[model samples]
Target: MRMPAAKKVKSLPPADVEAIFARFHEIEPEPKGELDYVNAFTLLVAVVLSAQATDAGVNKATKRLFQLAPSPAAMAALGVEGIEAEIKTIGLFRNKAKNVFALSQQLLERHGGEVPADRGSLEALPGVGRKTANVVLNIWFKQPTIAVDTHLFRVGNRTGLAVADNPLAVEQILLKVVPERFMLHAHHWLILHGRYICKARRPECWRCPIREWCRYEPKTPAPNGA
Candidate 1:
């Protein structure tokens, strides 16, 4: 069976974009990432483990792992095998375990047991990519960066806030469109919105807070028996 091609997304006008984010800001002035972590190191570890996995899953595994090895030095001491045992429930546990152990060692040896604030330094860590680096930078260090995950990508394109082929392109477009005041919290708001309201299978347009500003056509109607 041939699948229909995705519709071309039209970019929202600047005023519409501003109004959409204004509503978001009004609803939640301070949005936060759902990942559970104690410090920068734990946050980095949690994000690394979150690849191809949900935040809830990562939190469940990291609960015991973080209890045992909260810091870089501590995680390094746990060794790859120990880390593997702790995070075995998550997908790609073995490789993620190696990355966790190796990154911990790198932090200790090169960064003096600190998660660096710089993008280059953060990306240099094992298993860390652009999204992970952006998360750590924005959440931990207060940088205004949008990490384009699956949810954000969908929401951005669907709402006409950003229309791009890849995550990097979406990130750049969002950076250009979102207002300065809302930039820091924009990432969190968009991700949460996409995850809950603008779902991939069936977006709940009826209850969507920004439905008026959205450019997506054929909005799904409310199910029977409201």
Candidate 2:
């Protein structure tokens, strides 16, 4: 559902972005990724499935599938057909299934069935992109990497905190502007905020925590028809 449109978040200067991060650290302290997974391998798979899909959707699909194929060996054993049957509901399920199976085999052969911690190795795997690699690096390895997905792209652009055209540009801007202390949890905070509050549709300004810092158009009507 589209949220009520929010006023543009105030364009944050570099110092202002730093200050905002400081406040976020005080409030949430330790934000984490919303996608649920049992291990690094599972996290990687879940992220691959999450492209153009919601974490909730990926989690739902993985909840049962992961239990069945928790490891690379197990997933490879399942084969493409088995994996496809399991994840058929997700968009581009056929291709994703193929990638999942191929990646599982590659994992076993290349990394002893373990999900590699390094971004380069992770990117070498099928279906894993920079965003997926960044997510795995950040959530599983606790690296301070930003994975700018659509939510983040919108949040960054709409808020004017880190305006950019593509995810890569946004990622670069965020890395530069977001405070060091808030780097680890920055993805979660921005994603959650974008998902629930600063949505693409109308934003819910009344309950917004950072509405005061925003620069978008107000959702509420003026007191008088001026």
Best candidate according to TM-score: 1
RMSD of 2: 4.3
lDDT of each: 0.92, 0.82
lDDT of 2 by residue, 33-115 (tens): 77888988898999999887888888888888999999999999999999998898899999999999999999999999899
Q: Which runs in model 2 stand beyond 4 Å of their true positions?
A: 1-11, 219-226
After TM-score superposition, the amount by which residue 154's alpha carbon in candidate 1 deviates from its true location, in angstroms, is: 0.4
N/CA/C clash count, model 1: 0
lDDT of 1 at 212: 92
Off by over 4 Å in 1: 1-6
Give the range where candidate 2 is weakest over 10 consecutive residues by summed lDDT: 1-10
User: What is candidate 1's lDDT per residue for 1-226, written digit by digit as tens?
Assistant: 1122335679999999999999999999998888999999999999999998999999999999999999999999999999999999999999999999999999999999999999999999999999999999999999999998888988988999988777888899999999998999999999999999999899999999999989999889999986
TM-score, every prediction? 0.97, 0.89
